[model samples]
Target: MVRTAISRVILGVSIFAWVLLLINPGHIMSMEHCHVSDSGPSVSSLHMLLEMNPIASQLTGWGLMVVAMMFPKLIIPIQHIYARSLRRTRFSASLLFAFGYMAVWMAVGLLMIGVIMGLHLLMPGSYLPVTGLAVIAIIWQFSPVKQRCLNRGHNHLILATFGWAVYRDALLFGVIHGIWCVGAGWALMLLPMLLPSGHTFAMLVVTFIMLSEHLEHPKVPRWHVDFRAKLFRMIVAQIQIRLKEAQE
Candidate 1:
């Protein structure tokens, strides 16, 4: 347990540091550019310190998110065991499935970075990472899509299956967790992909939207219950149509 906690802390710190670096790469690049100068050498500002590197930022942020969302690995091993108990599956299979699920999101994260980078390249600047990440974060914070993500984080889970061992509850929990993550982070992840404007406005906007959800009454918020339902229904319908086509 101590080891796991230590690892979590390390992972969290590593991610936070990397993200900060990406957001301030210029600051890190020239430590002497700490601040404005009065006939003296300039210095890097706190902002530049945080925006040290974009690749590092993306990796750290996504890694931290996946780790946090994937805590069932240690917190609820029984769920995995339970899922296995229902079908007498091996431990290795559970690991494989859980990893496969994670792989899906990793791909999603990478796709987001790819899209963001493409947009950033077009902008062409020395401070691309800072502006790009901030913009993405802002959009995700305020957008209607961000509201759905915030709601999912705020809501509780629903268990669909039954009859699993106490030790195997991890698998069951894992299944639910897997679904929740993809549902919650899908559009947010797509922010990097979908948007062409490489600025932090999107990030700030999304942040405000999410912050509103946490409030008792959030006026001017992007999403409500209906928004989620509408998107979900559309998604379901699209999937059903595709399935029908395949079956036909």
Candidate 2:
């Protein structure tokens, strides 16, 4: 009961924070600038650090995004951990698991920033690189590798141990889950990263799409039929319902 309540509170806080960040126009502008700078290819790591404000802003922006976007998906796994863990260690294990999970994402965020910096250096003002990234992301959506990663993410193991084993298993589960999640959703995640405008909307859309993918049954990649048709229908139904609500 306590674990369930805690999970609900975490989800509520994450949603509230996400909404707050979405409305901040200034933060959006800063995030856009963080991806690609106007400065030439000569820019260095030291230079980026010297202009620490933007870096800090970028981290804050992405960190909030990770928390908001990833927390809901994490609820089930966390609840599972809480259920299996001893009462005295439940909170500690859960906290470590959450930290381990976010650590992977934070590392990935830095790597993404580095890639964007490289792209800015290479193309300066062209959108071709960003376009290519989007194309790659789209292709990745239908790839067999993505299906494999998604399957792994949904497959959970028994963590029925105690002491250091509990901590170890929790952290290990977090890292493994984080990796599979990134693998499964990197394409959708990249879409907002590449787009300079309407990032808040893009992020929200991507988050919804990623969440939807998890809700459906896992399928292996096949060339003959459209695998995402069900997902598309679900989205259309949601839009229609929202539209009707707005009109009423």
Candidate 3:
């Protein structure tokens, strides 16, 4: 009962954060470049974006984004940990597990920032890199490696049953899950990171895709041509259920 309540709270918080981000019209940091002198290379907008926001502010934005986008998908794993833990340490282990998972994503966000900055420096005023990234994302969606990682994410490891072992296992589970998730979803994630103009919308789409993938039953070599058909069926079923509920 307590575990279910905690999961519900986490899901509610995630939904609330997502809605808040949607309603806020301002960009987290503007990606618009300013011209200092027309004769020389244009000043990079990334520099200004970084200068305008303190590191803490940037991290906060990223953290909120991670929580909003990733937390819903984490519910199952968190519940699993909670179920395996003693009542006294259940919440503590779950909290540490969530923290460990978020830490990996935070590191990924930092890496993405560095990559975007480098690309801005390398190819100023060109959308080629972004386009390439989008292509990569699409191709990665069909890759065997992506399917392998996704499958690994769904596999449960044997966890320890006592004291510090509980905490350690939970944290390690989070780290491993985060790593596999990143590997499986990084390409979709890059779409928003590369294009700031449609960041929110792109992120919404990616989040949906990630959630759908997670909800899928595991299969050996899961990346197949019929994957989209399966996802389509799942989506249709969900919509029908929602509509039926509304009618009732």
Candidate 4:
């Protein structure tokens, strides 16, 4: 029941994020709109250190992107967290775990924003950055390091049952899982950011790719490609089930 509720909540949030992105398209976060002031060096430093509005808005959109594209990947981890916690504290433990996970992604989002901004400054309207990122993503997709990260992401640690330890364990588990997730998906995530138009469509495609990849079981790290078409198989199975039900 708890797992069901959590899944529903995560699904709803993911849907909400998608809706927001669709309604406004890239207005919430667009690398094109990210301003690079050609002004005083000292003031640029000040803005870099103190500017909150742009930074805050970027983070907000990045958070939504994370929810939309990444939350589905967390269902298994969330289930594991729920199953391992004490009955009374299961909800709290799961919440902490999610918070910790989001925290890591949020921090990485900041760094990603910086990189995107730098690229924008260097090449304002060119597709060079996007193309370059796509090439890098393809290379990363076949790299042993990415496979190692994917394998590590499947790991679930033992949880504590009492006091602060419970919360600590849950949070740390989330942090560790999130780090692996970042390692596996960062290149793909950046691809969508560099797109000039059709940002939502690009995001959807990237999300599908990432989610499909996550559906795979852990495997030994290797420099090989795996499309992990598990989602397609599941859809086919569901279609067959419905067809049989209709016939009966």
How do the candidates rank by TM-score, highest first? 4, 3, 2, 1
Model 1, which residues run further than 4 Å from truth?
1-65, 68-100, 126-179, 182-248
Q: On residues 84-107, what C-alpha lDDT tens digit does candidate 2 reach at each position? A: 778888788888888888888888
Ranking by lDDT: 4, 3, 2, 1
Least accurate 10 contiguous residues by lDDT in model 4: 32-41
Model 1, span 1-248: residue lDDT tens = 53465346535654564465347443321112223222232233323433543555565565544543333322233243333344444344345445545665676667765554443333422355545555665555457665554444433233233444422443444445455456545554444333434323544343333223333222344634422333345568999999999999
lDDT of 4 by residue, 22-71 (tens): 77553566643234433323456435533533777778889989988899
Q: Which stretches of candidate 3 lie over 4 Å from their true place?
A: 1-4, 23-26, 29-32, 36-49, 122-126, 226-232, 238-248
Q: Model 4 misses residue 175 by how many Å?
A: 0.5
- TM-scores of the candidates are 0.35, 0.80, 0.84, 0.88
Provide the lowest-lDDT 10-residue window in model 3: 30-39
lDDT of 3 at 17: 78
Candidate 4 local Cα displacement, residue 163, angstroms: 1.2
Clashes of 4: 0
Winner on TM-score (1 vs 2): 2
lDDT of 3: 0.74
Please list the residue runs of candidate 2 whose C-alpha ends up more than 4 Å from where it truly belongs after superposition.
1-7, 23-29, 32-39, 44-53, 123-126, 221-248
